[model samples]
Target: MRLMRIGEPGHERPVLASPEGRHHDLSSVTADIDGAFLAALADDPGLVPEPERLPETDIAGHRIGPPVARPSALLCIGQNYAAHAAESGAAPPEQPILFYKSPNTIVGPYDDVLIPRGSKKTDWEVELAVVIGRRASYLDSPADAAAHIAGYAVSNDVSERAFQLEESGGQWSKGKSCATFNPLGPVLVTADEAGDPQGMRLRSYVNGEPRQDSGTADMIFGVAHLVHHLSQYLVLEPGDIINTGTPQGVALSGRFPYLGDGDVMELEISGLGGQRSVCRPA
Candidate 1:
């Protein structure tokens, strides 16, 4: 099953997509698809009504919001893919490289991404996003990672090279935390139903041309390792997001020109659904 929210921003209605292709209203189950609701669902799966019992709803034309509302923390993994590190002209890190994008960067899957003022190095990154279902700290092992995860979603890790590389001195968050930089979700596919996180294929396109075509299997440090590794360093709260990382083929590689106004970016993961966004001036 997949959890979703549809309608205008700040006013979306919770929804659940069943395996049989039915979309049911989830408002009766929770106020919003947020940390509290995810934590409750983790504690009690029966809290949600059965698919057949909920009212079936049509959401064909409405806007799709981020499946989970503002996460308490929006964490990111850098250079998790070896090829991506090579493309960025850096040696593959021996351990996971962590960074943070402000939670406010979250926006709907189909929303417009803004080109930050005075920017010329905007780029696109398609990633598989992990949504935490419960708090975790100092996990015993990588195998324990799945239990704390709610599901997965597609994320666009939009970036500005100038801010990230030149102006920031050393830290990378400045280029990463701009408003509307992280475009996530059409829905969140529960872990049990999302198959193997490391087995899925993720891809991206800009204005109809393919930019990235790679599988998660290429990741140097897979999902479970990242989760387990992160828990040892910080307390991961429910509804926090971990953007596993993006594969090679971004503009930062110098193979393609930077993004400008009117460019369209479409990102997709095998089972997690896809996101198509337009670029506009901030």
Candidate 2:
């Protein structure tokens, strides 16, 4: 089922879209889409109520907030796509290139992405975001890692190239954590509904023009391996988010120019919903 949260920020209510297009309330089921609730939903499939009648909501009309309001951590991988790695003039890493983005950077779906003040190389990365469902540590294998996932969502890993590559002494996080950088969700699709995460077609468009377009097959490290690899270093807790890297075709790739104010970004993974945001001056 396509699960969503509605209402105002700091007051979102859980909801589900029924097969008949009715809005069945899951608010009666849970408070937020965090780790604990995810684990519970995983165990008790019946907890989510089927809405007899879809309720009217203004998700886009209301102030849409970040899908996961309070994620425990927001981890990201870099250069996980060989083409994207090559585009950025880097080699595929011997291991996953892991980094963290401050949770404060989280923003609502379709919100305007701010190009940081004094920035010139603002870039966009359309990526698949993994939301953790249960606590996991010392994963024995990639297959075991797959079971820990709660759902998937679309995300834009917005970057300030200058801060990410030059000003901050080469630390990618420096350019990655700008406020409103991680725009996530139109909806968080549960794992059962998001089949075969590895083969989906993912794309990014700026101002209605396509920029990055590729398949998840292009990923150097697939989801299971990434989860297994990451669990070796840190425990994967519920509500933690890991943004798998973007495919090639970013402005940094030179196929397209960098994003400027008023440029719009739209991204999608085949089964997951699409997300769109406009660029604006910081």
Candidate 3:
């Protein structure tokens, strides 16, 4: 099932998009699509209620907010794609390289992406975003990781190279945590319906020109491994999102130009849908 939140910014209401492309109101079943709601649904699927029984909501004139609410943590795997690692001039790591972007960086998929002031090397990354459904502290094996995943969504892991590399003091969050840096969702496809996370074709474009174009199969550390590995070091709270890293063809490779005001960013993942964001001055 595809879950969505519709309305303006903070006023978004939960919605379930039917196979026929209809939006059914989910507010009566729950208040919002936040961590608590996701955890409850994970424990009791019936808590979502039946969309056929709920009122049909018209989302045409409204904005579609991020499928999941602001999460407790926004974790990311860096250079998980071998080609991307090569482009960044690094050897494929023996283990998953992890980092954190402030959770508040999340914005509606269609929202305006701010080009942080004094930023000149802003870039975009198209990644498969994994959403957690349960608290995972330490999983017994990578196979156990599937049970903890709530779903998947498309995420644009926006970055500023200058802040991330040059002025980071060896830490990346300062550049990664800029407001509106993470443009997430158009919809969140449940894990059951999302199929295998490692096969989806994810791509990105800037101002209508192709940029990143690769599939999740290129990821050095797949979703299950990343989750299992991370659980040993940090708790994966319900509603937490893990950006599985982007493939080759980002501006960071010096093959394309950095984003600028008035630029349009289009990102998509197979089955999960797409996001189109407009860039503007912060």
Per-residue error for 203 in candidate 2, Å, reads 0.6
Name the better of 1 and 2 by lDDT: 1
Residue range with the least summed lDDT across 10 consecutive positions in model 3: 43-52
Model 1: pairs clashing at backbone N, Cα or C within 3 Å: none
| Candidate 2 residue runs with Cα over 4 Å from true position | 53-60
For lDDT, the strongest prediction is: 1
Per-residue lDDT over 1-282 for candidate 1, one digit per residue giving the tens place of the 0 to 100 score:
699999898999899999888899998889899999999999998888889999999999999899989799999999999999999999999999999999999999999999999999999999999999989999999999999999999999999989999998899999999999999998999888899999999999999999999999999999999999999999999899999999999999989888999999999999998999999999
Model 3, 150-248: lDDT tens per residue? 999999999999999999999999889999999999999999999999899998889999988899988899999999999999999999999999999
Clash count for each candidate, listed in order shown:
0, 3, 0
lDDT (Cα, tens digit) per residue for candidate 2, span 24-63: 5666567777777888876787767656543444444665
Q: In angstroms, how far off is 236's CA in candidate 3?
A: 0.9
Model 2 TM-score on a 0 to 1 scale = 0.94
How well does model 2 score by local distance difference test?
0.84
Q: Is candidate 2 or candidate 3 better by TM-score?
A: 3
> How do the candidates rank by lDDT, highest first?
1, 3, 2
TM-score of each: 0.98, 0.94, 0.99
Q: What is the lDDT of every predicted structure here?
A: 0.94, 0.84, 0.93
